[model samples]
Target: MMFRQLFDHASCTYTYLIADPVINAAILVDPVLEQVDRDLKLLDELGLTLQFCLETHIHADHVTGTGKLRDIAGCLGIVPQGAQASCADRYIQDLELLELGKVIIQALATPGHTDNHMAYMVNGNLILTGDALLIRGCGRTDFQGGDAGTLYDTITQRLFTLPDTTLVYPGHDYRGFTASTIGEEKQWNLRIVGRDRDSFVQFMSHLDLPDPKKMMEAIPANEECGRVSVVV
Candidate 1:
């Protein structure tokens, strides 16, 4: 198993690369459009063939590199079946398993931040949580059909059920913190650690976070697989 975590400072987004050493095949999760060159360089340096460019959800911050990667590298673009990312070549459902040589990536339909959000569990040990579960705070559920109660369920009922030692790699983090264990989050994530549904809802309701600055542009481009403008 080979893995690398790449970061986009502008949006605080984290992109993940995981490959099967035996076959030299790789998958990228939550790719950013502007970073396509860097990702490709890394893949080439490692002598890996790009098999899939996966999206955890349609992002509102940074446009996705799925289409470009596919066009240039001849890889498939995959997203959650309900993401409505019309430009993607394939959409996967909950529990669907994607194989890269010997590595298996399992989809977990844990919606909340966005109604179609999906987290990938790799080999039952590492979880690429996207926006669903963060280190000390989870994603906000105030837009894109977000529901606090549903998010609460996804966290307490689904993610927390994972093995305590499962390594959690979140999609974004504002602070310098990087990587956390399920057990640590269970104990320290103030937003959902000990709060009940109602309390969590109340807390999230008052957050009042401003929408991402790039939301207007990024969301549309992401849905269209990074086409900044559609040609009629």
Candidate 2:
């Protein structure tokens, strides 16, 4: 298995490239549209054929490259089940496996930041923790269909149970904290560690985060696979 983590400075988002050398097949996750040219160039240089373009959730921060990549690479677009993204070829469910060459991508439903959010585990070692978990914190639960209690349960019961050595690659980070282990987050994450459900909810409710600057534009564009047909 081969993987590369790409970062978009503007939105502090991380995009991923996972590939299998044997069959030369690859999949891209959470690609940013602005950086699609560079990503596509890299894929071309690597002699890999893109098999799938996967989205973890409908983003509220930046436009996605799923549609562009699908069109360019002629690959299938995969998204979380119930997320209404235009042109998505597959709607993944919890425990669904996507096989591309030697790489096996397993989908895990992790609804906290958003009701349709998902985390992808690659080869059982690397976990792509979309907006569900981050290095020192977790995603905000103040968005549409977001609930703090549900986030706590998802992290403690579902994600924290993974092996300590499992590498975590989050969807976004602004403080230069690129990645962390599941064990590290389970033990040290300020939001979800060592707190009861009620305390967690209270803490989350008190956090006065400003609404995302791109929310009014990004959400609707993201839902339409990066097109601006309707306003968010």
Query: Best by TM-score, which number?
Result: 1
lDDT (Cα, 0-100) at 162 in candidate 2: 96
lDDT string for model 1 (122-189, tens) is 98899999999988999998887788999999999999999999999999999987899999999999
Worst 10-residue lDDT window, candidate 2: 223-232
Clashes of 2: 0
Candidate 1 clash pair list: none
Model 2 TM-score relative to the real fold: 0.96
Show the lowest summed lDDT stretch of 10 residues, model 1.
Answer: 223-232
Q: 132-189 in candidate 2: lDDT tens per residue? A: 9988898999986889999999999999999999999999998998889999998899
Q: What TM-scores do the predictions have?
A: 0.97, 0.96
Model 2 stretches astray by more than 4 angstroms: 229-232
